[model samples]
Target: MQWGCMDFRLLTFGDLRLVDGKGSIVPFPEKGLLSICFLLTSSSTQKARAELAEFLWGDIPLDKALANLRQTLSRVKNRQDELGIELLLIDQATVSVNVRAFTNDLALLTAVSQTNPHTALEELLQLGRWDFLARTEVIGGSGRMWLRTQRDRIKTQMLTTLRDAISAMSEGADATVIKEAALRLFEAHPEDETVYQILGETYAGEPQLESARHIFESRRKYRWGELPVDPDPQTLSVARRLFERQRSVAPQLREQATPQLEIVPPVPRGPPKLVLLPPVNLASSHQTAVFLSSALLEDITVGLCVLKTVTMVAHYTAEKIALHLDRDAMLERYAINYVLDTRLNFDGSIYWLFAQLIYAGNDEVIWAERFSMEAQNLPRQHREIAQRIVASVASYIERNEFSRDYFERNPEAYRQYLLGQRHLKRLDLPDIRRARKAFQTALKENPYFSPALSGVARTYHLEWLVTAQGDARLLKLAEEEAGKAIATGQDIVGGYHQFGVAKLYQGAFDESIEAFELAETISPHYADVIADYADTLMHASKPGEALEKVERAIKLNPLSPDLYFWTAASANYSLQRYEDASAYIERMADPSQAARLAAASAAMAGDTRKAKALVRKVKETYPDFKIDTWLSIVPLREQWQKDQYREGLRRAGFD
Candidate 1:
């Protein structure tokens, strides 16, 4: 491709391209091109040769990888000379990109975002049209990993920039700009119902009656089926009302109002009411078998109701409804939104229970699963079966309610709790504090709300974790909040789960185990609680059991978080399975979060060079890191466990 440019121009947002001053594309090798992209995008625009080599050719031997990197640099240099531009500044130990010599689209986008966000928003909208590194080929595992991380970072930035721009726009802002921004946001997150509301309001405000009707129509079609040939009067009234509201607000507050001041519909109604019917005896099993299945379903119903996010029909009422001939009539009478139906069958030796959750409005099966156990083992496995069904039903009901904009009792409290959850998941220090505040607000609205109370406890525990301060006060606060949660809502799983985490960090292994056991008894299929329980087990010097629990947690949540892998790695490391530890570390979304453990695992596995590289990374990331101080803060129950980790760090060359 030819470009009319007097200076080197690189584009890294959508594709990797380098155009020379002569308006011609530079013919560079794939590795060389990737190396340039890497250097430019790096935080410091510089990296150690060893680190660069590992990123580019980590699968090969270090010496061979270094040799390959040297050749790549030579090729890049030749291209730079041909273009008469000094693109790279190479030294004996490090490689740095001369960013000032070249103009890149990503650089421009970032600079504009700080100075002129409206312009930046336009650029972001353009860049979001294609994936980052869209045309770049990364062969090495480490290189591909970096590419994934970069893409995620860029996408998050785009969303943030767009939201900020939209928020900053005043009432007098151009309708076209607002429409474009909202449309892009909707396209990026099609599942967010609020985005649809925004789009509809924007179009309505523009007085484009047809377009406004179409936006809401599209959303309705997405959720339910097609509307009638003639639009419902209620739907038309909604659009007209929105237009009137927008025009009224604009004239009064045109100069002072921002997008946030735009009118939003009132919070939706309470959680969906669910009814769990008694299991049908499809196989003419013995009365005892029928009783067993009924008991299991009852337990699941109890568990689901205890979550307090869904309203469950009373057991006696559900049982009476199940016996009625006209099930539709029964469901309608109870105003049920969801129905949990099950059938019990026996194949001589094993009893099988098949369960399904159906949306009552449409009679659609939202989720279905089957469980089988030998007749003799039915009693022992009842809790496990019940927990699985409860978890699945709860998950589907929550998604259903969210998509439909329904909230639990005290909608404001639930909204704040959800906001806190979003911040907590980011796992950054500042966001964690923000999450705590959000949760605190939720508690002020409803002090006895179990989820919000648990959320508050989690923030304190996570703050203590991320800060690495070993602050006893944080643990105490977490413990107190968790205790309040349990006292207010005895059957809720989150209370017990957070209590276990606090106790674990406080070095109360026995108490921690007891709390986790109770949590598992309440909700065995909660993947996060199980994962945290696994971490507690590992710290309590039971690596075998810890590994088993973590593995189960992964099965329950196939897309488990980085913390799950970190726990698995720690357990494997304690069991002297160094290779397994390293493998688990590799699965983490950001291995740097557990760099010390990764380094130790590598050293124990006899990969001294790799271990030392990770050690250097740790030092670079945390300049004042001391092995003794870190180990002292780590809550390892056994002295030998601490000794083993210290020895691994020592061998990894950590001071």
Candidate 2:
């Protein structure tokens, strides 16, 4: 064996480890290892000997701690002969790592994090496996503080690495990189409109137009109650051109391109991917059907965008390429696992739409439906169809992705949650009770499942609303369960939504709005949260703002649930627009709440006969609903709107 040979190495990625060139673990006592790691990771690569001794052995007597430090250094110094390298340099005043003797992982990471992010990608990905000194026993005080600072520094460097990587990819031909970069940047800076502009321009197409418009409109409405507007004139022009091109494209391209189709590629395993193919207009007589189809497709895309477990192609891209190529070839080219196909048939005034979800792997149809509606009711129909499609698709994809072991372990809980969702969709009193039972059953199986907890809370709130009479006990139960939901799922969108609704029913408007705002921030495109927030705003005496939010919700979810229409009616009524309020009230499928609003609107508009008839209809269902109880249940802050509501009800024969 050679004497005075030096071979020092270090590892700081997952854990702190040191070795000689012979690959033998360096002989270090606990204090010595901690001291080495601390000095090695510190930015200055040095620290005062006394300061380190005090930090590491603070609880011991000062002189004793100093003696221990000296003894530890003595042990480390003695090992230098065996290890063939000086790991540390010590003086009476201070100590530091021997930078000239050993190579360090920290140094490598720091240099790469700033200078070459593309090369650092693998290291950045590996950072999660081992936190900085995660296994080390860092108790309270300076040690913990130092560890915290180091962790933060590592995080900052990781983000820097990602940013630099994105910057390097900015000039590449890969749209996927640009899209991912824009998405990551937005995650870091959500309110940056410049990033929004970048994403909008990068994905410029008909689909982008609708999404950009919705984003701009939603932000303006939520902040200032402004009317909806297009994002920009330039984007608007490009979108229109794309839409026209799609409408004018010849239908024979599918056949023409079939002979020239390239070999299909295999889809990679990850999250489920879907492409929503453009709607095929079967009746050709209704040119306006093109706009309606585009609108529905975009609405469905927005609805589905909230799902974390699914990836989707841009609607305009899907619409453009899908029609020109063979379906199998198109799916393969995009690596899509499922395709949503919609066909529209318009004859004179009536429309029939068929939607099907097809599995790309086996060319099997998973779900299909046919919807028939008149031209006047197409908007409402669109919302209904989109909601159903999204629900079905989400359920299908999630169920299919579950592993055998997961299903075997949690089948009952999963089944109960699905049943609860189905019952909740019915939006009736008996169905609400059924949903509560299902959710409770799910909780019994897995008490910590946030979705089940949120479901149970929502069912109680729905019971209070659909029954048209407030039960304080039901509201209390709602609050308890919603609190549990928030506790279990602090960052989940559904928990915040349920919490907001629970607070709204309790007349805690400020708290309700705050919770809803958090949910909206988490899922900005979620129409139900937006609609619920609008209702809270109406009760909080901000009818103008409420109307704006309701309209924006409708824009996002054009075929929204019946509750949205009821909220819209109430908001319009608060604004004293009896005609608009009556129009919206008439759209509600639930007769109990519908009659209450319709009677009030008709009475206010000087239609006594119709108002009295509607009041009789409401009394038939809810004979004990006093104006005071109604007012209490749906509290309003504006004195004038309250007076108007009471007068309307009184004229319609309610006491």
What TM-score, computed on C-alpha atoms, does each candidate reach?
A: 0.42, 0.45
lDDT of 2 by residue, 1-655 (tens): 3323346666654556676677676656566667877877655678898768865764345688789889988888777655556768878888887777776566667666455656575544433342566567753233544564566566556555555555565332344443444344433333334343444444433222344455544543442243122233333444344445435545565234221101112234455676677675554555445545554465456445554345555554566655664767666766777787888776666677778888889988988887664443444444555555445554321111111122223545655665676566467799999989988998898787666788898888888877655687887677667667655545456667787777777776766776776666555556677888998899888988889998878654544567788889988888889889999977765646678878988998988999999988888877887998777667676678788889888987788
How many pairs of residues collide in each model?
A: 0, 1
Residue-level lDDT for 598 in candidate 2: 86
Error of 1 at 85 (Å): 96
Report clash pairs, candidate 1: none
Cα error of candidate 2 at position 638, Å: 3.3
lDDT of 2 at 246: 38
Query: Model 2 segments beyond 4 Å from truth?
Result: 1-303, 307-409, 467-469, 590-592
Q: List the residue pairs that clash in candidate 2.
A: 383-559
RMSD of each: 19.8, 20.0
Candidate 2: worst-modelled 10 consecutive residues by lDDT: 396-405
The TM-score leader among the candidates is 2
lDDT of 1 at 517: 75
What is the C-alpha lDDT profile of model 1 across 1-655, one tens digit per residue? 3233346777674557776676467665667667778877765688899879977875466799899989988888886677666677778899987777777667755675675556776666554443567767775434554565566556566556655666676766664655676676665544444455556555554433455556666756663342112333334455667656555664546455443324445355665677767775554536555655665455445445443335656454566677789989878865788887878777777777777888899989877877764443433344444444445444322121112111234655655665676576478899999989988997887787776788899999999988888889999889878867765565577778898999899997866877787776555455677889999999999999999999987754544578889999999999999999999999987999999999999999999999999999999989898889998888899999999999999999998
- TM-score of candidate 1 versus the correct structure, residues matched by position: 0.42
